[model samples]
Target: MTDKASNSLLAKLGNQLHKNKLVKAGEILLLFIFTYTFIKLIMPLAGDNPLLIQAVVWTANILMLIYVWIGLKLRGESWKDFGLVFGSISLRSAVKVTLLSLLVFVLAIAGFIIGSVIMANITGIPEGANMSGYDYLKGNIWMLIITLAGVYIVSSFGEEVIYRGFLINRISQIGNDSKKATIIAVILSSIIFGLIHYAWGPMGIVQTGFMGLALGISYIKLKKRLWILVLAHAYMDTILMAQLYMASN
Candidate 1:
């Protein structure tokens, strides 16, 4: 197919997102999942070049954001439709978001700790997330800086865009914007958010899933303040990276 024809087809599908939200939601979700899983599956082909792998991951993450951006544009909407206002951030709100981020950071930790306890009791297992994915940061300040950048784009910002801003909004649309729809959207989004950490292993999944629950609830309660959630996620990842860096000895 020619580029024009392909764009035409995608435009038609974008239109379906409005006319038939249920089906389109599934399609969007499958594409989202495929994007994540497929990239990870093909990652080994990139060999052991850390910079190359990081670049690929960063590109994939940015592309995911772009996909969301394009989808919104195709529907005659944009990030503004979802309350992501990056402009005009006053210091008062900045301070507020920072303080809230600390609180959310605490809640996230509590969630993981509680989840770890419950999971251990239920399964009699104690293995945690296979964080070896980040083991590359051990004693590597340069890589630490690089991974911190990834935390901002990939884990903190991009995940919020994909999971909260896009997924919650899309799923809620499937419910015709009812309160129940919002509740279900948060729950399902949290579940998917948790599952996405599958590389973390079973205990890791539970831990992250619980963390997702905390973040989802906060997102709703805070009136979908995306920046606050983004900062909160950044705070969590920052501390995690710091710990990893410190463990290098």
Candidate 2:
């Protein structure tokens, strides 16, 4: 029985890989697994009330992944097609992409700072509310390092691959015209990205959604060379992690 089960599983894996459906299945499976891990393990370990936030986060994440996959599949792309989406196809391409990505990171940081300042002034929300946790991390370097690494993996690679790599590529196939398709993809993906953060409240939704638009537009503008955006995203999140660490301590 065990041997038969193993064979069956291997067959399924082979089919997914050969058919290039691996990304679709992987995206779904990863989201589910992470959500499960967050609620069942991370929450308890961190002393967070998983019931208050994690359940909602899981639902949003799963739905978004499903939606993106359906859209991509409908557009006739196999998961293998996503391989070329990350960076440039050549060394020159890599250099150009890296520079562009760095520029975007700097701009995003500026935008976040400006937006936070404006919001605080207009709504009387404290500028430092978001910075509180960063202070705590400053006092605990090891924990901060671990947390940064975790964010780098989860936020940069996981989120970027699923959203920019998978979702946008799929949506970019919708319209017959490339330009039209790119526009639609950017708008739709950005909106979905924002909606997923509803658990963080209105500010989170807007901030994340805006960032989505920025990333999507950058990707589209770069002709979908994914490497540039991925690096930019990782760096941006790294900065955020650093800030959070500082605030926490």
Candidate 3:
């Protein structure tokens, strides 16, 4: 291709990866790495302590707001669009949360069974079949609660805002195919969510993949109302925390 044509192609590709849900998910994965590295770098300056973890988590949450704001600006959506965030009747939201919570609970039980079976078959030890992530939660109940409230809530809602609300909606506009866009967004976001726990070992990947799909499907089915998935996630995490707390003592 000629120089101008090549440059045009590059620009189009950039825009595609920036705007498409599947493509943009890869970009978001890069953000995860960047944020991790930045946290590591800043830890030394701030002292390697619990306060450092809190600072990094809070900074990540703030980044979520910036991500959502940028997405809204790109779509020309005003504060009015945000008002839809609060449009659901209290009863409706309650029903949605209840249903979603049940779905997540069922899926989580199935996941644990599957994980146990796989681990037992592979390792030839039934006792060692438990999930490390669950073990971690059990051992660190208070920390898990803190992490869930501080990071999980922000990350889940931030993800819904950017992936489903903004990227999927924008792609639907470009292609005039809402279903395709939603599917693309959910799958890509789930994959990125799974990858983010690469540091968490194989079990982390498995656990997060299950979680990502559960939340993603919930978002797609609920028409991206956001609050429903947020409540479902929070409820799930809080219950896990509570269970861990009770079991530990």
- RMSD (Cα, Å) for all candidates, in order, is 2.7, 7.0, 7.1
Q: In candidate 3, what are the lDDT values of residues 38-132, reduced to their tens digit?
A: 76777567554544555665686567567556545444455335323554468876786678667765664465456556655766765531233
**Clash pairs detected, candidate 1:** none
Q: Per-model C-alpha lDDT, please?
A: 0.82, 0.62, 0.58
- Best candidate per lDDT, number? 1
TM-score of each: 0.88, 0.62, 0.63
Give the runs in model 2 whose Cα sits over 4 Å from its true position: 1-80, 83-94, 110-138, 176-178
The candidates, ranked best first by lDDT, are: 1, 2, 3
Using TM-score as the yardstick, the better of models 2 and 3 is 3
Candidate 1 residue spans exceeding 4 A from truth: 1-14, 47-57
> lDDT tens digits, residues 1-249, model 1?
999999898888778878797765775676678687867886887787655665766777787888888778778787877768868878998898899878887887888898899899989987777776666788989989978987798989998888888888888888897999998988888888888788678888889878888888888888888888888899888989988887879
TM-score of model number 3: 0.63
State the lDDT of candidate 2 residue by residue for 95-186, as single tens digits. Answer: 78778889877665654555456556777874332333234456677966775665555566557767777767645543433888778878
Model 2 lDDT on a 0 to 1 scale: 0.62
| Candidate 2: worst-modelled 10 consecutive residues by lDDT | 126-135
Count of steric clashes across candidates, in order: 0, 20, 0
Indicate which candidate wins on TM-score: 1
